[model samples]
Target chain A: MGVIIAKSLNEACVVLAENPATTVLAGGTDLMVQANRGMQSMDSVLDLSRILELKEWTLKDSEIVLGAGISYTDLAEPQIATVVPALAQAARTVGSPQIRNAGTLGGNLATASPAGDTIPVLVAMDAVLQLKSSSGNREVAITDFITGVKSNALQAGEIIQSITMPVFQGPQEFLKVGTRNAMVISVVSLALVTDYLGRKLRVGVGSVSPVPFRATEAEEFISQEFDWEKNSSLSEKVINKFSDMVADSTKPIDDHRGTADYRKHAVGILAKRALERVCANGES
Target chain B: MTSEIYTLTVNGNDYQILDGHPSESLLWVLRERLELSGSKNACEEGECGSCTVLLDGEIVCSCLVLAASAVGREIVTIEGLGSGNEISDVQQAFVDAGAVQCGFCTPGLLVAIDQLLNTNPDPDDLTVREAISGNLCRCTGYGRILEAVRIASNSRTVQNEEEKGK
Candidate 1:
């Protein structure tokens, strides 16, 4: 077993190109846990912690590009929270202070867990991932990046560089239901993002599916029903209908955390509450 | 399975890990190789904060950190929090508040509370609760632990006031 600590992106890419099978270690929040349990083989590892470029985030005009190495603690900072409140909200609900300090956004994406708190928020925001290899770089939409449970579309020799998302000037909310209040994996999570400039409302649902996914049906329904310009209140009937659509979009399973029926029911309630909070013009 | 050699800077001291494996956790290296067992190993996973340590001054689960990956970074374990023969203010507060039960979770909690007080000396009850939410204690139902944090925060405030008066 060998550990190759790369101080730069170019160096890491070269190593990956030479050995595509080398396990990439960012924060090691997930990888190390697996290694401790004998579930992961650390025969060869490309440590990306020394790469400073991956730890910095840039706020471009009307867009935010976050480095994959940006820790959850950094994500909850005032600068990031101001621009992407849902992402920060989700980041706060992550494991713990220790986990938040060590876990990186890129690590969450690379792990590709369906229950990842940040994945649904990224999906709702229409984020895109920049993947790089020694050969070249490519961009993949967040929705397409996560292929399935604990799986991603990252090609061999490629590393996630950064995530880019447009800055929406609207209320965005993320809600997660876990077994306990803290340090528990999400039984079902939801993100609701309103894009006033685009005249669109996007909903992302997680944990209740093989992949965190955007609820296009529910989003479309809410976009058409809600009065965006007036910021009018949504009636109970409309909210219930929208919530049902969000619930209908999930593919939850019966696991230890929760039952499929319960997940479906809970996600709908989350959707209803989120809609009420975001749309009711401060009534909720 | 080959052993590797690496240097880890812990608590202002550099130690050479001669028998370190690439996959070994910082927690393992700290307890076994360096013999700094102050950072407990309750959960090898990140769920429990027993293995919490300061990596580059930020709290992180040592169990979730790769030993080799932590190269060239400053690490502060529970053992490193105080000066010679003198327990830190947080440690003293824990004793005063009777927060140490079974003593298994004390080391990690002390490290966490010390970090919290360093950053926010006057944290509110909610902030204190949030700060120690990661460090779970089955004993005392957390009332004494909360009291310990309050006591530490109050003492720090008093110390600051005294220095100001000087």
Candidate 2:
């Protein structure tokens, strides 16, 4: 195998464009695991960690423009917590501080794992990703970008350059249940965002499906069926019905962490918890 | 593989390696090349905090750190703590509090606590637990480490007060 040392983003892009078969290495958190397990083989490798342009993060037009290479450590700052608590929450739950500092959002997007903790939060926010190649750049929504489990619409030679998400007015939260307290992968994860303006609700359930997905049916019921204009009180029957709907929407497969039924049940519990938190915050 | 010549200022000492591979981890380089055996290599997969080290004043798993990627940076291992040929205050506290069980997890725990107390001296119990949550210990159940951090903080505070009085 050969390695290409890229000192700049442009150089990395050019290298990726030239060697379509080369694997791009950002933080090496994900790639190292694959390589160690003999899950990947490549003719070339392009190291992108030294590219400073891809590591920046800023705000523009009330939207957060996050560089793809911004580590979870960078996003866990107090400023990000104030502006985008959901993202910050998700970032805080990611592995340990060491992994948080080394892992990049682009790597998560590239992996497209159903268990990717931050993707659901990004999806619930209607996040857009900027894809760049030697040719040019184009923006794509996160939902459309991820086609399936471990499958993505990213074309060859294109790298995720940046991601943008709107700053919404309502409350949002990201939750996950892992094996242990720290440095454990999710068993079942959830990202719940409320779009209060249009009376629209967004719910995303991860680790319970092929890819992180929205609970549209339950979302509809919570936003429309409930008579919130008169009273925000919800009965047990209603919550049970919503949980059943969430269970039916997911297509989880039994894996090492949990059974399909267990994951479905956990997702339902997480959805209910998320709804409770959102409603509890509504009063304050 | 193409390699880079890098100089790392580690624990007030400088190391110059000519063939540091970018993907090669710093833990092995520190142990094998430089012969600093303080950090353990248990669970090289980053799950166990046995390879914990201070990189540029932050606790990070040395197994996951690429040696060439840490150029022009500062690193502190377990050996760097305390005075010359003596343990630091925190290390002494750990021993006093019976925090060392099998001692395999001692180096990483010491490094983890060193970074934490150095940054946050008067951390509460919950804060200490959170700070060292990444470090795992098979024996002792972490009751001793908890007591150790608190005791170390209190002793340090008292020592400071005595100096001021004098």
Candidate 3:
């Protein structure tokens, strides 16, 4: 097999343009596992781990721009954690310390695993994914980026450039229920981000859907019912209603990890827990 | 497909491997080609941390790293943790605490504990448990391993203090 160690984003783009079918290797937390399991066989690989540009991140105009190569360990940094605590919280739940050291957010997005721990957080934050090809650059919403389970909207020769998300206001919470506490794939995950100033809340659900999706109806309901100034606490009635709406939005499939019914119940529980946590933190 | 020459900086020494494949994992190259079997290959999948090694001073599962991609990077296996015929403090602590049983997970646990101590010298019980969460020991039930890491941290702190006094 042919391998090219890409040193820069531009060089990697050139390689991808020339070899559109080449597998893009990031941290290899997933790809290498498939290779070892005899599940994946590749003729050529475009190694983007060494690309400095992809590993760097910048925050401008209140929107955080994270390079695709930024590892989970990097996402757990104090700087990133401060800006997007939910994303950092989601990143912290990804695998073990060793896996976090190598596994990257870009790899997670590219893999497009419905159970990807961070995908729900990205969706809740309304992350915009940037894809670059020889032709040009295009931006797609995180919800649109993931077309199906383990399938994405990335075209041939196009690589994930960076992910940009506006810094969320108010409190944000990400909760994942898995088989184990660490190094476990999420059975059902929920991310809740409340915009107190905007009087809106965003809810993103994962694992129970073909692709991670936002509970738009739930969000609308929460935004209208949640009295930020009047209500001292999250009402149980509101929590139950919000959870039901979030659960209703998901189309979970029964797999070996969990059943659809269980996922629906778990999603409601997670959504309620996340919303409760966010409410407990007080405003802003 | 033809094999290519891959050079890795292992334990501060450079070794040139003539039969490295892109499909081959770093764990395979380390154990088979370099004969560094300290890092066990319990699970080729990243689910198990038995093949844990330090890549550029950060612990990562060697099984998840491509041999071809490891070129020019620094890698330290379990064998690199100790000097000639002398075990590391963490290893000694494991012995003292009876953390070793079947010993299949010892090497990876030691590497993970060492890295954890290097970054956090005084980790609490929860920190130690979280640090070694990836490593699985079917025999010890994690009680002795946690004690071993605590002992290692205590000894290391004392040593550092003594050095400061000297």
Best model per lDDT: 1
Off by over 4 Å in 3: none
lDDT tens digits by residue: candidate 1, B114-158: 999999999999898888888888887999999989898999999
Q: Could you say which candidate leads in TM-score?
A: 1
Which parts of model 1 have CA positions greater than 4 angstroms off? Answer: A281-284
lDDT of 2 at A10: 83
Off by over 4 Å in 2: A1-7, A37-45, A226-231, B2-5, B18-22, B160-166
Top-DockQ structure, candidate number: 1
DockQ for all candidate structures vs. native: 0.75, 0.38, 0.72
Evaluated at residue A12, the lDDT of candidate 3 is 86
Scoring the B chain of model 1 against the true B chain gives a TM-score of 0.97
Tens digits of per-residue lDDT for model 2, B35-153: 89999988777777888888878788888766656666689999899989988989999989998989888899889888887777788887888787778899989999899998899
Error of 3 at A272 (Å): 1.1
Which prediction has more favorable DockQ, 2 or 3? 3
What lDDT score is found at residue A65 in candidate 2? 83
Q: Flag clash pairs in model 2.
A: none
Preferred candidate (DockQ higher): 1 or 3:
1
